[model samples]
Target: MSPRLVLVGPPGAGKSSVGRRLARHLGVELRDTDADIERTAGKSITDIFIDDGEPAFRELERAAVAAALAEHEGVLALGGGAVGHAETRAALRGHTVVFLDVGLADAVGRVGLNRDRPLLLDSPRAQLKRLLDERRPLYEEVASVTVVTTGRSIDEVVQEVILHV
Candidate 1:
């Protein structure tokens, strides 16, 4: 069977970091939609949003996410906002999705205020809280398994994800 897994969470929940390690442990390719979009656009996500606006960037992200699902069999780390797309969320149903849950403090610590993350443009603590509040329900609704990621080593999280997968 195809080893298809999706990692869902807000920024700084270690989706990309854990994803690479998980893919390594699982012996599958790691396909990160953010990286894919960056490569496709020939620019960073921040640049995409600045030049083309958020709606345009979302369009690009949606397309890249769908393409990754179609073309790859590996751990897929989506951008923090990718789950906001109803169609993409629908497509994720019945697949193995693990929500790497992180509180505002942890997320803020993991990602400083001056990062390239578009959504994290404001005060990181408040912004992270807002984002977590906004995306929390959506993540839970779509996830087959939820893993609390704060204070845990990457190996621990990877083990949990492997268990769920």
Candidate 2:
């Protein structure tokens, strides 16, 4: 069977960019769970966060992640917080999950105080670290492999995932 790979990481950890390139290299379609959630919700994710609460947005994300896992056999890039939900984390069992581990500084540099990220809204760098600290264990729990992306180019990260996955 062609390998089905799931890329998980904090926001700005290169999941979407790496996933797209990796999928291209592997000749498989790339399914981004965040985009799936946005489409399913019939609104942009930022809009959902503004109108509905975080809980509601999470529910939508959870649904989208579950659906993508169940139906898609290609590469998938999950939103950073997808693993924080127990049900979603549990669903990852037996699937090959690659954690693109980027440090707080690199992540902040990649994300750049983008308030569009629902969870990071108004939070400082310390808050980003705290969030990563909180979710790190969960990501570790489900990840079949962890690839650090700090100080690495997108090609380097994709090569690492390609070799590992």
Candidate 3:
């Protein structure tokens, strides 16, 4: 069986949170590629990035996403930069992909310049803006539905996703 819903978006877009709720609401398991990566590497994403670099982390990420997409029959949440890879986007072709869009303001609050988030370690606001600029189009391209998560609560976002998914 294939995933019933796949969530793709930038960090702080609430993919994991909404995914858990949506999965529970739908009575399905929630498979997060990031968590999968951490489990596989036996380290946090930041540690992987710092110890192994982004290229290495991305390779792991791509593999995890591919495996989850092929094997899971539930709600799947991809890492923020997963769609940056062409193969990941292509792999999403026949799946119900949802893009959770969040503005910089909300994103900064949700995803601060925390040590855990390697990408956002330097100037979170600016970095987030750049990330959004580079990745928004890609997210839109693969998304069957785009849910703006700015100012919306988790429940509200879940409702919107439920309506679309």
Candidate 4:
């Protein structure tokens, strides 16, 4: 079992939204690793971060990604930082990974002071920018195709992704 499509991007890059629509369009289920981690851990991601710290959360995320990649024959959406793990990046080989590229302005606008995002607790704009900058290469490295979601509608992005798949 494996994903028909895998979406990767920073927060506010529309991974969840696009993943849902894409999966529906493709007549498949959407499995988000973040959601998976939360389900398995029986806690929210923010709480996991607070209680277990980033490293622990990342470990859970890695395992979740591996499980989803191996077991889910549907659409999969990964947390923004999942690409930071070298093992995850290597594991992405031969998968149909899409990088949902979003600009800082669009990202900030979408995420805007959202407290639930554990990484964006301080100066969301700056933090988002840094995340985008730091993770763009990793996203690119793992992606088979890239879709810019900066000003595009979900439909538009989904259509483009469909073309790639």
Candidate 5:
């Protein structure tokens, strides 16, 4: 099975929130690869990063994303870095991937001081800016449509996503 919609973006881009509402609006389930990875690992993402390291965490994320893309028939929201994997990007070729683009300021505000994010634990603002800059092209490469979520409400973002899907 294939997903009806796939959401990709950096952290605080509202992929999870938008995915949930979009799934409900479309009368389908929402599968988030990050949650799936956490479940399969039997630990939190931060713990995985602490124990196994970023490369290891990324491997698990890649697998989780591939599995979800292959098996899920609902809306799928990918981990922010999923697009960094070449295989995952190739696999997203035919799916309706939406890039939830959010500016640095909005992203920093949305995810402020959240310790759950391992990548942002040190100097969140600068780190987030680097991540957004580095990952923007990858997100754009796989996405069929792009939705700017900066300064917009969740409802507005959801509605914009609905139009493309």
Candidate 6:
């Protein structure tokens, strides 16, 4: 079996949190590409980016997403920038991809633009805005359904996804 639902969106858009709840609701496990990449590399995403660069990390992400799409019969959540890669978007074509959209303010509040996030190392708000702008189109391009997550509770988001999927 393949993934029942796949999630894509910007950072702090609640993909991980919402994916967890959605997976629980659907009685399936949650397979997160970011976590899988970290596990496979034996390093955190931040370290991978700093040491190996974005291109290298994207390669790992692409591989992880492909594997999850093939092997995980559950809910899958991808890292924020995963959709930027052409190959990743192509791989999502036949899946039920959900885009969780969040505004800048809500994102900052949720993620705190923390140090652990490699991409947000400097001027987090500006960086996040740029990321959202660049990636929103990609998310829209691949999403089977788009869910706006600003100011909504996890249960609300889960309910909406359940109704759609």
TM-score of each candidate? 0.96, 0.95, 0.98, 0.99, 0.99, 0.98
| Model 4 CA lDDT for position 52 | 95
Candidate 5's residue-wise lDDT over 81-141, tens digit each?
9999999999999999999999999999999999989999999999999999999999999
In candidate 3 the C-alpha lDDT for residue 89 amounts to 94
What are the lDDT scores of the predictions, listed in order? 0.89, 0.89, 0.95, 0.96, 0.95, 0.93
Per-residue accuracy of model 6 over 28-129 as CA lDDT, tens digit each: 999999999999999999999999999999999999998999999999999999998899899999899999999999998888859878999899999999
Off by over 4 Å in 1: 1-3
| Model 2 misplaced regions, further than 4 Å | 1-3
What root-mean-square deviation over C-alphas does model 1 reach? 1.2
lDDT of 2 by residue, 1-165 (tens): 323899999987999999999999989999998899888889888889899988999999899888888889899999999998999998998899999999989999998878678677776577789888998998999999999999999999999888887
Off by over 4 Å in 3: none
Report RMSD (Å) for each prediction in the order shown: 1.2, 1.5, 0.7, 0.5, 0.5, 0.7
Whose TM-score is higher: candidate 1's or candidate 4's? 4
Ordered list by lDDT, greatest first: 4, 5, 3, 6, 2, 1
Q: Judged by lDDT against the true structure, how good is candidate 1?
A: 0.89
Q: What count of clashes does model 5 give?
A: 0
RMSD over all Cα atoms, model 6:
0.7
Alpha carbon deviation, residue 15, candidate 4 (Å): 0.5
- Clash count, one per candidate: 0, 0, 0, 0, 0, 0
Candidate 4, backbone clash total: 0
